[model samples]
Target: MLSRPDVAVVGAGPVGLGIAWRCAARGLRVVVHDPAPGSGASHVAAGMLAPVAEAYFGEHELTGLLTASAARWPAFAAELTAATGADIGYRTEGTLMVGLTADDLAEARRLWAYQQGLGLPVTPLRPSALRDREPALAPRVRGGALAATDHQVDPRRLVPALRTAAERAGATLLPTAVRRLSDVDARVTVVAAGCGAAALTGLPVRPVKGQVLRLRAPGGVPPGFRHVIRGYADGEHVYLVPREDGEVVVGATVEERTDTDVSAGAVLRLLRAAVDLLPELAEYDLVETLAGLRPGTPDNAPILGPLPDRPGVLLATGHHRHGIVLTPVTADLIADLVVTGTPDPLLAPFTPARFLPPNPAGPVGVTGPVGVAELAESADSAGIAGSAATGGSAATAGSASVVRSAAGVAPAVPAVGGRTGPGPSAPEEEHTWN
Candidate 1:
């Protein structure tokens, strides 16, 4: 039997790492388990950190979360880098949403207007102005929008840095896969396991498959594209993210309720759209193609904070594609909740109980929320002992709390930094692509 920890965090992706790091930072003994630590979606992400550009319809909650996370990134990066001596390649170059055709332009305009309606800082740009700002864009492009507050970081660098920082913070990282959460009994167990959450039982998390392509920047291709460029064409969203080393990553096709295999059709479709956006990309060498699963939830938002039906368990998964952008804030909030028993106000809307049937009295019986006991019971009812073992723990019964319940629950809100919110414009700073 493993020693009990204050917290046992499942999955070692960015979210899990972030939780473990934050918990350890607060002096909590943390144990993190993953088959391959840092080798999940977090590592495979394009690392676009562009909350504004990645905006979706009816994702206000996610947008708020992203904004909060973006605001916390600088301090998080600085501390991690200082401790691990690793450069996470954080950049504040902003992002450009370009349109290569009339349809693209119309969509860009619509999105820009929507952003404006949300009180977000978005600047409309003509084709000529866009070309002037980013000479690499095709001259035929008509218009675009500039979200100067959207920034990016290199996931490859950031994940490793986070892993190092978590270790330095004294979290025990187990390289072995956790077949079951029953292996340890902690004061709290957080299920932050991305797509793998479903396999652990009781968690309603499922995989939303996504595929991305990596290409080597050709000679004469600028060493770095200052801003992440994204656009829609052929009914798909395509992005070109340039790394400092001249490796341009063009990605991502979202396929729901399926296995995470890089489909040739998806690759062809993505590359075709990428070349359509920037014809010059045709000259680059295709290097790698990979696929990963983003954790999907019912509302397309993360299931955060404590579970109403499970006292010592927390739900921190289901971030979908915004996981990379929301990492820092998620970590901070999880740590705050576990250490002090208080959660961030922003986390209220994402409570796991939102998915549970409302019980005025309290959670009871087997049909409450998708908590630990419910999952374990379901597995047993199905005679799936393996699943039950993996599911882990008992459920607690209570209504959600509106009050701060403990001392370590709220971190002193630090001075916000990075490009976030509708703020005054600043000169574009030089940013490394990697």
Candidate 2:
């Protein structure tokens, strides 16, 4: 085991790995804990860097964060690739939001007006222009908008690249579920485990279920499209994202539950809507179906910064559907807090303190690091069970591996300086949609 780490991260998803990478690059002793590294929401994300397309009317603050994060993706991807010598498949072809009917066009116009009000960089595209840009789109498409700055990266490749870069930067990767923060011997512990953080901190984070499909374009048939298509048909939002490889990702259904089942109805709805937008997709082979849980909060914004009453613990979950898009900025802001004990202004609106009740107790920091035995004893007294260091489980259906839910029993300990038990077992050997 390495020396006692200065910081401990509780999740191994892209956000957690990015934080670890940045901290380690700054010479901070860092350790990341995850039962299955790089196999959470990240594994199933379509990796669309679409801040402009994702902006909602009332989420101005969130839009700012998303746009800032989007701006950082290019440099972040480049640096990660340069450091790890791994291709992350960062695509800059942009995105097209098209409507298949008059009603859909009206809805698109409403959104375009909203974007215009926000002074976003969206260009109104006529039907001819839209077709010229992406001839694969259905001829019936009425109108659309082009978010030329929005791009994408393959999360399957991004996660692994982040892990490699962080490891190379001297961050120790511990494939163990972190059940409790007291178990870690570090000065600070970061709860970035998506919904799993709710278990440790009693935060308001919960899981929002989503399902998506992956399809393969026929070999040299109908040719592949260049731009990502977010089309509306029969009031359904279906997106077709093409990869450098001959694969197109179609998604997703947003349901509010923890059920990991990939329903036939969801598959049908997505495919029916996608095929209506681009007929060629119907000829594409059905490659995979996936379902994942996005960690959500009441406001659907991330809760960053240190916990109010808990000392030595920071919250970094509740990203909802924007986890992939927000990774770079989340990592940057979190590394800032971890390295300098001072929060950045960019994190002011998303601070954990915003969720605290009135008359909150003054700030507290865990006095000193506790030994593994003492930490385990405390956890036992608290009735939190420890998670074993076993290999990762197979992904539920086609989603990322079943995440360690916070609503379960037997909480795991965050091994800080050195792990007390056997090392984590290998990740579940399985096929990814890559």
Candidate 3:
């Protein structure tokens, strides 16, 4: 193993690479370890930087975090491209949520109301109006909502660009897997390993599987289908993200506790949903199918900041499906927490301790020997808690508390449908491409 650097980042996905990049940019000696860096979910993601479309039933706080990250993308992408000379394909074409049927229209209306309630910028469009904006959409489209702030990036290009940028910023990357936390002891260690974080000794992260399909436009299909399209069909959510090239990405199914395998049945369901939204997709060439696991927490919000008991350890995982969209802000928060000993106040709602109680049961993971009070005190002194809780904030002393009783010490398994699965096992080896 190499000597402990100023920072040791685990899991070289986008978030990990982002942290290493930011830290190295500040002249900190950083080392990133991952058996395969960009080959994880970052490789398989459709790369829609859409915080608004992915909003769920009651996640206003998470939405705030997402919007903040979306706002930061342009600068992040530009800086990385300037540093590495690689185009990450950042696009600001926005996104459209379409409804093909009456029920879908009603749901769209309800979602629009919810977004309005959250003070989001959304515009309701009738079927005719939607067609006017996107001429390629099927005329049968009933209605839609437009989120003009939504954007996207090309994940295939982004991950590699981040790796190159981080190296250019003077971060060392080790293309080897880290088996445990004891492998490094720095001022801080961040677990941004996506689904792999659960296998580390004391983390409370688990894998939630997602599958996606990629298609190439047939010859003569006019290129430039701007805006990511999310559709409501048969009571399920599906999306199609068009890239600068002819590739259109359609995805994904949220399956819990399954190994990564691209199912033909899943692909068919995706295709049907996409064609239903825009019939023209049927003319595209089916090019690829793939699957990857997202690191999901109990609340589906990321577990940010220092681990409850592990003073020197920090968590940047459990981003769930929004990992790609949230990477830049998450990385900035990680570096801020490590170098300055505090997180921005905006990140308060997502603290890992939010899932832990005032007094946790077992040994605190890799954070060392501090309790929550001490951790909060240190963070507060550093002014990390002053910023909007959008990036990092002090764990509230008593909100949505998760007290790990004797029963909470079991191995980490993904929280699915309000219940925990079988305990953790050896990290499963799986791969997919889209």
Candidate 4:
């Protein structure tokens, strides 16, 4: 048994570790629990910090959160590096959103327009201009846009750095699994357990299966391309993230399934899409192919703030694909909340109460692609006056999410479809910015 700490954080993924580090740095006694700290979706993620390319219709609140978090990444990366002396492979080469065909260009244009309307910087580029930036792009690539703010980091390195920083800051790490909230003895307990948050809190945080591939350059040489390439290739949306160490991260398929098996179809589709966008990838060594699950929520946004049913328990899960980019802000906000016992306004839009049964009397609870803000409207229509509508704003229609309710408690299942960018808006791009 471990000594009771001031704060106990469940799960040791990047988010949990970051929170632990922040809290410990604030002079609080912190302990993090997880058998495997860095073995979740954050390890499997490509780590594209793309709030601009990821901005889609009906996700204004999430977009705001993403942009705020992205802004914090620069300072966060620098502080972490200075503290741990670990190079997390953070890069600011920005991202290129391209289209391989005329039709693909048309679809991409729609998304870009939506992104631009939000005051995001998305500059349209001619094929010639794009090639000037990255000559390795397929010549047939019709056109593309540039989101200069969309950066990337190597998640594999980041997880370890966070763990080290947390430990250095006087936070204790326990190689134990927390199955229930009652098991932990702390003044405040945060559930940052990724997909496991569902089993612990009965909140809707599901496992969104994503398969990723890592490729090495020929003879260990660096990739020819400098920018992260996210595009619509013959209708298949794909992204390619390059690293300074001659490794290219190619990913992923968003499936509702929970299994981690990497299917042949997923590999072929990914490779085909990648090669279609950048023919040079065909020659690179196909190194690692693996699958992991991203924790998704009913509104496709993270679940923050205190649990309505459990006072001392706070939630910091259901980040889905934006885990890497959102980490800095998540850590800061959650740590501040822990220190002050006050929630930031940014957290108001995404709350666990959003998923609670609107009318516990009627089996009506939250599930599937519905925005937490919409819960307020649902409550109004049901004639049930409750806080399900509190601290939430309207998440416009055309939203993709995961939610489930059973016996007034829904085991966290990923809000599967609430992805943004590419492929007819709703269930947009699950593989874009993880």
Candidate 5:
């Protein structure tokens, strides 16, 4: 048997799994390493496929990148669903950017102007019109804009589907952490681990912590939300995403931190803002409260592509809050680069060479990839394994575990399409930005 795979993907988050799936589907012998495949930022992601809704100032480049990926979601979702036989709960009804005060309406006008300037498809709505679209919205809403192209997916479903699809496509999932990289003699190795990539890739991948909450309607009751609602209440951004099974996800609180503590203050603020937007939410059951870390860059954009001097290494981390939205595009582009050795024009601006100094190394060593220092000898002494060809056989340590309920109580598994599964426990992604 070959000692090394054609590609070794570090990090089994959505982005990593997506890349592994694409590479394996293209006939590459691939292996993926992660403590948990779909947890981390992906587990807490709101899975909003909102390019237009997420647009902001001086991010036109990111907008183009996001829009390109957003355009790929429909086909990508359908293909993955067809392959995995799992419904990812992809909703296309669109997103409403509502304002709940006169001040909020002013902000909405500014956002609407910006969207219009970009030639984005957004429809302006009066308070009455907003109520007509989503009657559950608070009557205090002053006005809003609807980005009909924006959509969402349930990352909880997406992660499993991607994992199953990747394994089915022949990618081996090694449930362990990758603290360093060495010569694998493969075409390319990718580091897609969220904040964990910073240690291995030597890139400035920071974790932006966000706390989110999940709510469920009373049994036999409907969530009463037809489209995703992104509303501004008292100057805070709040969103309500309804699931097919009567669970509504209301999140999140953005705090720049490194710890994973789910603070009561954050939860109070999130739920309070959620109820301000959709008053009916006060009657729902608060099922979960969790915190996650989004792998962010200094500029809040992703760092992608290969290292100029590293012959077989790629950097696909630093997606920040947009990891889930950009998964498909990142997977396709990275897979193409790994297999064909050609850089797509879209990847030009995101090359890892932009961050690292150039150097030529004839062999993989204590120091692997570009600009990355040697792995600590202590790590090797701890039996975590080391060196060029060690794809550390699937260690049970740090294996993906079942998500626990965030409330420190038992989780309520809701039935979807007649199948009961784990409910929201820990972190996922955000539907709104701070």
Candidate 6:
């Protein structure tokens, strides 16, 4: 008998379970360890499988990976469901990128042009076309476009299905948290521990908190809309994902903090925008309010491949907001590296070595999100992001040290460095919606 399992995976979230499943299916002995498996983005994210929408400027590499993974979602979802005999709530009605106000439409047009320049199929649609897809959308919606390949899945159902599939594939789950890398004894140790991985590997992974609210439709019926709605209402960027079971996941407030408290301000902002776009949502009953953290990296890209300066170790963490949508591709790529002992070309750009030599001075500088505030007539909003490299939130303050949360009030902090002070300002023209 073998002395130990071939693979000892740290983390039991969807990414960890997915890697375990793929490895076990290939006849590898895999044991996954975690204190709470599905306690991360699996429960918090809106689960938007939107590559075209995610394709941002200066992040083509990450965009390529996202697009590749999104392409595999259909087959991956089907296989997971078949293996577990459970529904993952995968939907492919596509996404409607709408704008409720003329300003929203104009700002989005610049992004649409940039996206189209990159050859993405972001087809503009008339107001009538948008309503035809989602009649419940407020009649005032000016116009929008269609990202026909942008889809969604319910992460609440997805995690359970991934766990069931991994277990059935001969992988073992140990309900134990790995506090140190030295304790694991396996031929290969893969750390897919999300934010926890940073503590274990000294990586730059950090926690990005997001607050989300779940609402259920009345009368036991599905939501009136068929397509996922990622749009701006009254200049606030928000996304509405409706499920087949009469549930709509309206969220979320992105913050640079670590706490998971669901603020009343977040709920009010999200619900206001949601109802403004979809009037029928006003009747939905608020069912649950929760918050979760996304694992973020320094460069805003997933860290794959072997750990630099460490042999027999691999990483599969720092997925950030794209974790749910990027699960299949990450799992497959990590498993392939473990099985063949070779990193794929696609993994070359995201290696841990990029931030190597261990900065002895201190943690890496602020290459991350700044608290963003927007000026609205009757409402205000705030947000943050996972990393510095993926285009941090727009800040008129022009300094990274001005990090703060948007809690529906303008900050009164005095100006610093003679630049625009840290507070709510006019929404800077940019492509921040993802």
Kindly provide the TM-score of model 3 when superposed on the true structure, using C-alpha atoms: 0.82
Error of 4 at 283 (Å): 0.7
lDDT of each: 0.70, 0.75, 0.72, 0.79, 0.73, 0.74
The residue ranges of model 6 lying beyond 4 angstroms of the native Cα positions read 358-434
TM-scores of the models, in the order given = 0.81, 0.83, 0.82, 0.83, 0.81, 0.81
Residue-level lDDT tens digits of model 6 in 177-293: 776776677666888988888777777989898898899999869989889988889988788899999999987776899898999989999999999899999999999999988
Model 1 spans with C-alpha error above 4 angstroms: 1-3, 219-224, 363-434
Give the Cα RMSD of candidate 2. 11.1
**Regions more than 4 Å wrong, model 3:** 1-3, 220-224, 360-434
Per-residue lDDT of candidate 2, residues 283-319 (tens digit): 8999899999889999989987767645456778889
What overall lDDT, based on C-alpha atoms, would model 2 receive against the true structure?
Answer: 0.75
Tens-digit per-residue lDDT, 150-243, candidate 3: 8899889988998898898778888767766655555457778777777663456777889999888887354447778888875667988987
Give the C-alpha miss distance for residue 186 in model 4, angstroms: 0.4
TM-score of 2: 0.83
In candidate 4, what residue range of length 10 has the lowest lDDT sum?
Answer: 424-433
Local accuracy of candidate 4 as per-residue lDDT tens digits, 1-434: 55447678998999999999987776667899998889999989999999999898999999999999999899899999998999999999999999999999999999999999999999999999999999999988999999999999999999999999999978999998876676677666888998988877778898899999999999988898999999999898899999988999998799998999999999999999999999999999999999999999878999986665354567899999999998998888777665444455677687677787554563223222222232233234444222221111222221212222222222121121332222112221111111
Q: Which pairs clash inside model 1?
A: 243-433, 244-433, 244-434, 309-396, 340-408, 340-409
Q: TM-score: which is higher, 3 or 5? A: 3
Task: Show how many residue pairs clash in every candidate, following the order shown.
Answer: 6, 2, 19, 10, 8, 1
Ranking, lDDT, top scorer first: 4, 2, 6, 5, 3, 1
Model 5 pairs whose backbones collide? 43-427, 43-428, 44-427, 44-428, 44-429, 45-428, 45-429, 46-429
Error of 4 at 116 (Å): 0.3
Which residue runs of candidate 4 sit more than 4 Å off their true CA positions? 1-3, 358-434
TM-score of 4: 0.83
* Candidate 1 residue-wise lDDT, 162-224, digit = tens: 888888878888766655545435656787888766555355777788899998877635443
